[model samples]
Target: MPTQGWSELGGRLRAMREAAGVSLNAMAAKTHYSKPYLSQLERGIRAAGSDHVTAYSRALNVAADALSGPSQDPLRVAHEWLVADTPVALHREAGRRVGESLVDELERRVIELRLLDDTIGGGDLIPLVRRELADTAEVVKCGSYTEPVGRRLRIVVGELAQLVGWVASDAGNYLEAERTYLDGVSAAQEAGDSALAGQLLSSLAYQMSDVGNPADAALLAKSAVAGARTASPVVRTLLLERVAWANARSRDREATRRALDAVDDAYEERSPGIAEPHWVYWMSRDEIDVMAGRCLIEMGDPVSAAPLLTAAIDGYDADHAREVALYQTWLAESYARAGELDAARGVIERARSAAADVNSVRLIRRVEAIRRLVS
Candidate 1:
């Protein structure tokens, strides 16, 4: 049989390494593969076997599958694919096609994992999703592509950064989340995607609010709204709502009212031509009602907040245990603030039950806080 296209494989691997920003010397040192051997492999003078593939994959923080072969015997497939005598362009195109397909599948999986986390709660599942995201990032970074391919790679990178930020946020690693969100913002800007940048800024603002920096959060939210001016109406409305929440946190009643009014205006004027980002798909009117109620509660207007919170809790899907728990906790607190002791107790019980279902420490803490408020 003809020797496989080792030269093409070698070139692709070299390109991948460069795209990943890993120096050959650095990879060699990390993998203990020796600089000369790595050079031979990259030049197509020597085929990289499974061992070498694994070592290099580990060094580059990528999935071994990219270097190895097909899922069944990826290392063998990789070696064969590299040395095939067809045009280098053809091989490169094949790799690009494969990478795009994988990226799309990985994106769907990531979204599914996120939805599951909301339903089943966030523990081991988060790390698993992070690992998968990292793998997808590696694939995008490694695969050869034209200019359009590079754009897709940048998009994937930005999305991976966002997912990393959310995972860190769920883990209570707020500082790490902030760093990841910053990375995402840079990637989005580099991709020349203002809508993605706006979403990243909104997420960053939420992270800031989580850390109790309402002023900074409000500023960021406002910046997001301004940046997303040309974005879809739904996106603009979402950003405005976030700004309103931040204003509520900062006790800027007039600003909060203005932001809320903007949200209403945007919603009323929403056109079928406008499209929301996938991440904001769950943000419906009921969710907005919950958000507004929470703002009211923070503003010490429990009488005005109670009904909205109750409506949100009632509207929330029971399958989303963690969110249900959070909404229930908010409801309980609202009832307590309104001095409805009996109703507060019942809501607290539901909150505790939902908290148990999710096993979320944060939700448990909220439940405790609600109980204290009622007591």
Candidate 2:
């Protein structure tokens, strides 16, 4: 196998293990490998033979053939065959698979954006992604695939559009972002994908709130909530939380209370049957608490905000080091608001250390804002 091929496979395996919530020890026990050995395999420090691949596939409950197949080799004959195939039938099938892979790539990129938050620097990747997305959209618009495949393609397009919107918004090009998001909403509607529409609307609302248009944000958030009723329970919970977020930004006491109530209602209704989209995976209870805390701080209730913000900063995923830092900055601001200068200074030091690990303009801007508040 090419080195890059092994590296990509290792990365995918690691991602799968993380997504399934399997600890390294648990994976080792299931695969009958030593913990250190498994770690090496995941890090691509050791080449995995077919037997090891099979064992891992079994442990991960995925197809052994798929995991250990010749396709795993980027320079393998099968890859060449796919690349060189020119027959219409073969070309179509290959294109479909490539499109699917691109969708997965897009999803991964979105996760990176969320975790790193603007720390990656520059907007260079955005246009490349948008071009790929436009290609996918064209394939779907052709409507040559069967209904099931076409539906999947449309969903991918919607997701791509949402990502485009996010990148545009981050780059401070709100008009383009709005157009992209609106396009996504329309595509979702065409595919009867109400959940995706709600997600796009919620993202747009978040952008609006960040740019100081709380009233418009709240309106968009309400529309998201209305559309979310047709989504799965987990989606509804996230959308409701977003509604709370918008209301909190608007500083509308009654609206905020009602939005929080709605969040509770949705959370209470959540069940195992409710399938969550990949984008909403990080919206945990801790994140919701942070949103509430931010809202309270904006409403001039520092007494109520401090503890919640503290918990939020503490509960943030450590692997998302940049986000943890951003939350810490917010926590410091909350402490300063409550006249706890020593505590605020301590948190600021932590934030500064974390910021060093990730060079994000957005995080830097947030730190500047907190400094202005405390000083």
Candidate 3:
């Protein structure tokens, strides 16, 4: 114990325990370790017994080595969690009658969290949303539930995973987002939920399109359309919109125009009052218009994009701090394209103000883009 400096290990243990929402007194009670000992252990002054390592791990609800080991790589931990097999007993025990009400509650929570993502940028919400994804996955993994309930829970998990992935993308965790999206896609397919899988694929395409992988974006977007071929009119239209944007990102003007026309036609067929997928509840004429404007701006047709971007900004809700900032940047770009430098400056300033309210990685990048334009 003296050979190892306890500071780092102690810090890790303390942080993990705190992150797990366990207090010293509660941990002491659960681990049957004294509170003073626990406190000193965290301060790197006291050496814990070998038995205490397992006890602490249990009390903290983590792997024993997470506390006992000197160098536990977080990525390794995540990989292990992802690829490790669930215990046979746990899987079988899950058949004991998971309630429908639990599934309903999780579904409601997913909807609320999606709204949170819309209102608040991912920078401030990634960790929280990741925790939500973990909790839902935990329920599916450990809860005793009937087959029907299990299926419903799996579907909810897929949706949450996709949402988490999107939040990660918004927060600039591109690799993490991709991994989360793949996990969600697998869960959705396992549950026979094509629509959710398609939405997630589209999200991946959207991320790729913005992050400078237009070729990959185009492929994924097309796959999303294919996957959701039987989805509602609104859903297909939204996927097609992504396809348009992807093509635009790649500077394929003709393909972009074709996809855009398809989007418009599908939009016209969308019935206003029918039940649509909850994942796309926020989509509307306004959202479509913004995407259209973004595609035009990317395709060097800012003249056509300017009015549409302005209209979206005018109608965008205040709670969407990041998108409001981002959209304004797009409008500013459009103005600059037409030699309206003064108008561009005015719009960029307003965008700067909105950007102050958001904590998004994407918003910051756009802010920089606007700055470069004016400079």
lDDT by residue (tens digit), candidate 2, 1-375? 112344455666777778778999998889767788767667865444434555677787887545543332212322343344322234356654334444444344333333233233224335544664676677676535566666666776787788778766655677888889999998888888989999999989987887759899999988987876777766887887777778878888788878877776776676433445656645556776777777777777877987887877775535455568777887888888889988888888788777665545556677777877776
The candidate maximizing lDDT is 3
lDDT of 3 by residue, 164-189 (tens): 99889888999999999989988888
TM-scores of the models, in the order given = 0.70, 0.69, 0.73
Clashes of each: 10, 1, 4
Give the whole-model CA lDDT for all candidates, comma-separated: 0.68, 0.67, 0.77
In model 3, the number of clashes is 4
**TM-score: model 2 vs. ground truth:** 0.69
For lDDT, candidate 1 versus 2, the one ahead is 1
Off by over 4 Å in 2: 1-128, 356-359
**Pairs of colliding residues, candidate 3:** 97-145, 98-144, 98-145, 98-146
